[model samples]
Target: MNNSFGLTHIVQFFLFVALQVLLMDNLVLYSTGFCFIYVAFLLYLPLTINRVWLLILGFIVGFTVDIFYDTMGIHAAASVLLAFLRPHVLNLLTPRDGYDSSDAVNIHVMGTRWFLTYAFTLILFHHTAVFFLETINSQTFLYTLVKVLISTLFTGIVVIIMQLLFFSPKRERIDYR
Candidate 1:
């Protein structure tokens, strides 16, 4: 990564983590719809970043959250799983026109439908893994499932709002040599 990109992501990493721990962490809706907004940092990473870096970033973010929440390794496991699945999810959701490698993965570039599907799927995957791991020894599958589903939807909504409100579409001009 270039200096600017690296700096930007560093700022974003701390910002997302800060917001998650300080604000969203305490804003539980009915003790079910938890919003894990920090995942947006992983979701919006540059498309050019390699899978290994993705995994590393994911673990770092998750571990940071785990430390704050005292949740052991559940966040790390879920974040790693999300990072591992990211490229596969992109491939599966590739548009007919295909995406440029440098394209920023956001609602502006991918459209509402694609963004919704992508965000919801990954958030659901991450939340499910987290809740399952958190309650592995408990016999509350139904309760855990409800939490996962509700939290997934809530997180997805927050992600979409962030994208819509803050992110703008990049306009690239191609030079045909």
Candidate 2:
């Protein structure tokens, strides 16, 4: 990626993180309800991005969120896992011949069902990992599960909204090399 693109990604990541931590973190519906807009960063990555860079970006984004929430390394670990699994998930959802040259993943292009399934699966994985690690030694299995479900759903909804609102399709360019 060029310096401008890298800088833009960094800026977007920070903006999402700030919105998640500063705004959505405190905007709870029920006692256990909380939205996570930061996941949008992971969900919106280009399909053709390098896996290594994706993982690194995930870790950095999650760790940054952790710093704000004081959750230690839980978010970092989960985000890396989500990043690592993204390509596999995308591959499973999209056929080999259906890869879009633009690398943008959205309902308009990937189909609503496919896109929702993709988003839900990754969000679930991330929430599962995070909640499991957070409650490793605790005896509150049911409580943790509830929190995970609610938070995951809330986060997923926010991600979908932000994606639909702020995301745009990337233009496809031919490489004649």
Instruction: Return the top candidate by TM-score.
Output: 1
> What TM-score would each prediction reach against the true structure?
0.93, 0.88
Q: Residues 1-177, candidate 1, lDDT per residue (tens digit)?
A: 567778778999999999999999899999989999989999988766789999999999999999999999889999999999999998999989888765677787778899898889999999999999998857799999999999999999999999888886644321111
Model 1 TM-score is: 0.93
Clashing pairs in 1: none
Q: What does candidate 2's lDDT look like per residue over 1-177, in tens digits?
A: 567667767888989999988898889877666676777788877788889999999999999999999999998999999999999998898776778565466656676787889998999889889888988957888887888889888888887776677655442332211
Which candidate comes out best when scored by lDDT?
1
Per-residue lDDT value at 25 in model 1: 82
Model 2 — which ten-residue stretch has the worst lDDT? 168-177
lDDT of each: 0.89, 0.81
